[model samples]
Target: MKLKLVLVEPEGMINFGFILRLSKNFEVDELAVVRPKFQVDHEEVLRFAAQGKDYIEKVKVYESYEEALEGTKVCTSAKVSGTDTVRDFVLPWELKEYVGEPEVLSLVFGRESVGLTREELSKCDLLLHIPASKNYPVLNLSHAVAITLYEVWKQYRLERGNLPQKPSEKDLEVFMRVAGELAERFVGDEVKRERILIGVKRLISKASKSELRSLLYLLSRCSSFLKG
Candidate 1:
């Protein structure tokens, strides 16, 4: 499947450098970052990414995570083992069923200090965790990038299966709008309500358009039911 990789508030420039290399390694089409801690001109990242300088420049920068995930199916990477918020959260290999063939995808990596926040993880349709030794669960940011991308690319080469159907951009927008309306309706207070809306947007980012169409229809029926 066609995919892009995103890094959120990356603290290590060196990791960014190697991740850029990994992007090309996996044939990933885009790289998006959200408010990186270090400047792009910083030597640590730039020097290590000398070979991938051109690719690095092509990396899109966003003021926030939302901006980076706009119009993309965002997937979050986790360090924990067992399933949680998103069921069936598995290693990249198990995700083969979802990948092979072609679809727009975005894999997100969070900073080292505090992995992805609960708020950020809520936005993803799928959560992926690299299987690591229980003794030491944490993985270096760049290493995690290399391992996950490799598994994804390996799966792509082996299966090469087609998807049931791909969703259109228009379908996704309508679904988002419908979801937004539902969230605003459910959460009455304005401040807390906005947070709920953000969660909904994140949850749907990874859904296929066909999946979303079904969801939109369900949401419509729910709206009518509420009225009665």
Candidate 2:
């Protein structure tokens, strides 16, 4: 699985440099920063980056979070644990299962102090939370990125380019598009409508190829019926 590490509105120069290093170490396809607070070329950023300092010039800076994550399935990180739609999330270890069919994955992370907001977290296609003790679950920004990348590497590297057959990307995109239309057609509440779309997208990500065929066919037929 190809990974892109995305940090939103980050403020720490140290975390910035460490993340650059992590991106290099983990082979992340891209390192994207949204509205960063520090100068990317600052001396402190270079100092902390160590061997990773070469990547300083390679960072992709964005003006907004939406612009940063344009064309990838967004798997967001959070620190909380709950059943609420906004906070409900998959564990980092289980992320390999969600990488299905899609080649590029954007792993979006929030700021150092407060993490992703409820609205931002809720809009994610797949939410991931690294489990920790009840007393203090929040991890430092770089550490959290480290753990998540390590887990992704641990699982995906074992595949050795021998992943199981799944629906083609074109087919998956059509399935998601139709499913989204159906959700918009039937679900009245805009927020609930989005949750339905997110839930369906997550299910599609986790489904086996055979299972996806059936689910896709069902959703397509439903959409056709509504269109008629």
RMSD of each: 19.9, 17.7
Candidate 1, residues 143-215, lDDT tens digits: the string is 9888888887777643434454556677777777777777788878988878876776677777776777888
Name the lDDT of candidate 2.
Answer: 0.79
Model 2, range 153-213, lDDT digits (tens) per residue?
A: 7876645345555777776788888887877777889999898888878778877677788
Highest TM-score among the candidates is held by which one?
2
The segments of candidate 2 whose C-alpha lies over 4 angstroms from its true place after superposition are: 71-78, 158-228
Model 1 Cα displacement at 220 (Å)?
73
**How much does candidate 1 score in TM-score?**
0.62
Runs in model 1 deviating more than 4 A are 70-74, 81-83, 86-88, 99-102, 157-228
Deviation from native of the Cα of residue 206 in model 2, angstroms: 32
- Residue-pair clashes per candidate, as listed? 1, 0
